[model samples]
Target: MEKDSGKHPLFFVTERLEFPPVEYTNEEGLLAVGGDLSPERLLLAYQSGIFPWFNEDSLILWWSPDPRMVLFPNKIKISKSMRKVLDSGQFRLTKNTRFDDVIDLCAQSPRKDQHGTWITQSMKKAYKRLHEIGMAKSYEVWEGSELVGGLYGIDLGHVFCGESMFSKVSNASKFAFIKLAQDLEKKNYKLIDCQVYTPHLESLGAEEMPRENFIKILNEKN
Candidate 1:
């Protein structure tokens, strides 16, 4: 994957846990910039397709952007008014119970033109230590005992890397992203990364692709 004389890679990773080969990223897909999100460097940065976006006043910024923005969990797109708001069950989905109140309300939601929050506070204690070693998760959309909507990510078995979402009312984050994409398409989960690009996740069906075919589906072993 050669090409790296333009200076970008910088993850000494406390003496190398390694991560500089997504074609040695640079033209804005950054690559590395001082790592330490340690859940073994965020599971070796999503097993090398890489992640960790910046902006709690910058500096810990690694990425692998290219065309990325995935979704594929059985092509998730249920529009007829979101299937009548999931058959009007009136929101009450939960997984991983509360995940520090759905990542403290997705680090205090609010990001149209963006101003702050890349879910910082050491990325919420390094994703609550990758949700206490299970590889990070959280999808709550309750409305009974309150907690409006939710989302959280990084589940890389077959990739579920979402990362952020919030909503206090109106459709409650699209019913917590359509019940986490129909429960990761009943566990077959080939993808969901949605790393960048938004028209609200391209109207629920996320698309984009090539970063060398998403690192060839992140070097599949699932």
Candidate 2:
């Protein structure tokens, strides 16, 4: 999840939809500011291993943090209990079936120690457009007919730049994630870009990778 704190200090902002090298980012990985979320810009950003993470109150903040968090698809860990959750078949998953509902639910899901969401209205529209164009994708989890949890992200073939996820019921989002990793593993994906660290993701085998290494992998995979 892109649940980042604070902002870059007085970096240059441009109305032009361009980003500098990830190496130019401040210590916090705030690259440049003030770019529109156009499809071309968004795709270029992901391809460069950068993503936007500002809220409505601030200008669009693109980030490419050092010690980036990532999950190799083959390394995803499923605890014994979670394995049972999957074995029980309590929930089902779908891909690109309910992108709109998945993103909207993720925006509404609450986070501890966080107020409001970073998934702004314009952000949603931009990503939705990407989805329409096959550059973005979503995975949905359902219990019976009710949608419970899911995630959405930019798909750059071998590298999936995960944006965010939400779970309404226990283990629902985990189900979605595990399913995604397994499916992607079968498809020969190199990694899932978790963006930053969180205990929740670490439990599922996400680890911090050097920024240069991450960018190198993106280049190699893309």
Best-fitting candidate, scored by TM-score: 2
Query: What count of clashes does model 1 give?
Result: 0
Candidate 2's C-alpha runs over 4 A off are 1-17
Candidate lDDT values, in order: 0.81, 0.90
Candidate 1 residue 99 Cα shift, in angstroms, is 11
TM-score of every model versus the real structure: 0.35, 0.94
Please provide, for model 2 over 1-222, each residue's C-alpha lDDT reduced to its tens digit, 9 standing for 90 to 100.
Answer: 122254534345455666677887888788877768899989989999889999989988889999899999999999999999999989988899999989999999999999999999999999999999999999999999999999999999999999999999999999989999999999999999999999999999999999999989999943
What are the per-residue Cα lDDT tens digits for candidate 1 across 1-222? Answer: 122354664443344677767776767787767657878878878878888887887778778889889988777788898789888888888898888788888889988888878888988998988898888989888878898988888888887888888898988887888788888889887888888888878888889998898888778876
User: Lowest-lDDT window of 10 residues in candidate 1?
Assistant: 1-10
